[model samples]
Target: MTKTYQIQSYFNFLKRSTNQHGVHSPFVYDLVTKCFYDKKKYPAYQNIKAYRQHLLSNTTTLEITDLGSGSQVFKTTKRSISKMASVAGSNYNDAKLLYRLTHYLQCDSILELGTSLGIATQALALGRPKAALTTIEGCPNISAAAKASFKKFDLKYIDVVTNDFSEAINGLKTNHYDLVYFDGNHQKEATLQYFETLLPTITNDTVFIFDDIYWSKDMTAAWNIIKQHPKVTVTIDTYKFGFVFFRQEQAKEHFTIRL
Candidate 1:
């Protein structure tokens, strides 16, 4: 992470970003007011926090197989569970945002490309307990750890698939998903390839969320290309994540919001 680049990007985002006050799109306005700015302390947050704590305290070690852009913080393949959870897992705020989005949309079928420690997966499951979720993890050891967390948290709605992202995506039987989260691959080519491959599995109502859009210059370039796609009707850039909507009813528009 380049601190100087991030600081510059954030300042640029602030210059164009707005709250609900300036939003003209009705759907986006409602989302901003009802979901993004929602201050309700959901009860599910406690369980999510407890699950995170468990991972933090875990001292078990595992040999990680990283198929995506390797971690910037950790170079070694052998790592402690606590360290992985601390450095690789999604932060509380972003995980909560995922929870809120899942809950608000009431997504019936969700697909997650990455299941690192299952922290975000737990949030998604808690958000919509009835929703069927399939999360993919390339590393068998890490996937096993995530599965244990899911079982420990009683998050039975999620199905953990241990395979590379491309193979996992190819093996998916579902024709369409209500929500798709792209977090496994951070490189530009891989991210774009996944997006194109999954394009056919999306309905007009499908929502796609890309994590770490600003992780690298290439990731940002990929995000820019994705937002400009003909199928994408609306996009929201939150610095940490980039959200793509494919509503036929909505006119093509883009938003950069400060969270």
Candidate 2:
């Protein structure tokens, strides 16, 4: 999880990545141009921005529980909200992109695997405020803090669950999600396990976003294997995030996009 290394890797990705002009598929082209590269200023961005500011200004501290691969930036169990906001939170652009993608997809049922400080979750919530959204967090204190933030931001519509990702996701057997955000566990096997478990819940229009695909070699291998899965008809690797789509009508294709 070295930023310098990740920054160096971006050059290699840039060489391999393309823009809307290079995208042949109609769906992908529209996504790349209209959603991914969209320059429109969304009104919901104000809420997202305000939420982030609060996180940065907040001095409250919480005792964290590491359920997956432990934090690389944080060494101790106790950390300040501002510290997490600065170190663990989604980048501002990424937060905006998540909102845009949610708006673009118009997915009514959304599930988020990791809540952390709920920065990304807040973006997703603002993306489609009315959608039945559920986010899971392994740490109880973190979940409580996120829940409070949702209330502060008037995003009471989001349902925050405090539980391990595996346990929470397994209990949702009957529920199907139109969009799923995978950000909780970065380890390889756990990521794969989550993918398999949720595979049955996806529809032809479902969209899955996997964060930090290049966090480790194990994660890169996981991304490659996920691309080869039969049901995953389309995949877009932006280096930072891997976007998966399951459209039976489309041919299996993978793209590396410069984002």
Candidate 3:
């Protein structure tokens, strides 16, 4: 059922998705042409790929504890580190896009909701080494494993917090982030709750990126609700990811761009 839903959702995305040519907004056009469509082979990309590869080569197994919309790919609590890195972490394309996005946006501070294997977090940090990044993982063991991976790669400018996202966000209210990447809870209610709670932390140029927006019906509906929110000025749905911008200077527009 999940696979079928994703197929249908992807087809819908293809029908609605456009290229930079279709975008009239200068902000979006620049992002599409300069960032999303960029083909440069950045040096940080080497580190990003190596980070995931390092995790993939590890065979260490750990007892798992899922705190969000449970895994779509795993069936057991006992899983190998390599299996998690192979099946659960962000893929090369998405991670590389994240690297480009971090550089393109010149994000000075970033927040990541889920740090599963720290695949995305690695990309975020390597993309902008100077940016202060805080990544929260719900499960202690998983967080520990990811933190270990970070240290192995000698990646800096990261703060890992092991706690439920609700508690984690409570302590971050006074901080403003250039970007927030939501890869934590995929359910509708939790996603919405987090969105509302994080609303106060966004500046006009802040961007929010959501992973697996088409992974489930409820998630897609949550994306719709987020799109219509009063604070959102621009949004881009890339099938694998959804980008939300809170630029008050721009007109409200939703773009579906194939990445």
Q: Which of the numbered candidates is closest to the native, going by highest TM-score?
A: 3
Note the residue pairs that clash in candidate 3: none
* C-alpha lDDT of all candidate models, in order: 0.90, 0.91, 0.92
- How well is each residue in 89-144 modelled by candidate 3, as lDDT tens digits? 99998899999999999999999999989999999987788899999999998999
Q: Please write out the lDDT profile of model 2 over residues 1-259, one tens digit for every residue.
A: 4566677677888989888888999999999999999998888888888999999999998898989888879999999999999999898999999999889999799999999999999999888889999999999999999998988888967989999898888988678899999998999999999999998889999999999998877888899999999889999999989999999999999999988
Q: Candidate 1 vs candidate 2: which has greater lDDT?
A: 2
Evaluated at residue 40, the lDDT of candidate 1 is 97
- Candidate with more favorable, higher lDDT: 2 or 3: 3
lDDT for 255 (candidate 3): 92
For 1-259, candidate 1 gives per-residue lDDT tens digits of 5656677877887898888887899888888888888899999898889998999999999998899999888879999999988988998988888899899988999999999999899888888998999999999999999998888788878999999999889877456899999998899999999999899889988999999888878888999999999999999998888999999999899998888
TM-score (all chains, Cα) for each model: 0.97, 0.97, 0.98
RMSD of each: 1.2, 1.2, 0.7
lDDT of 1 at 167: 87
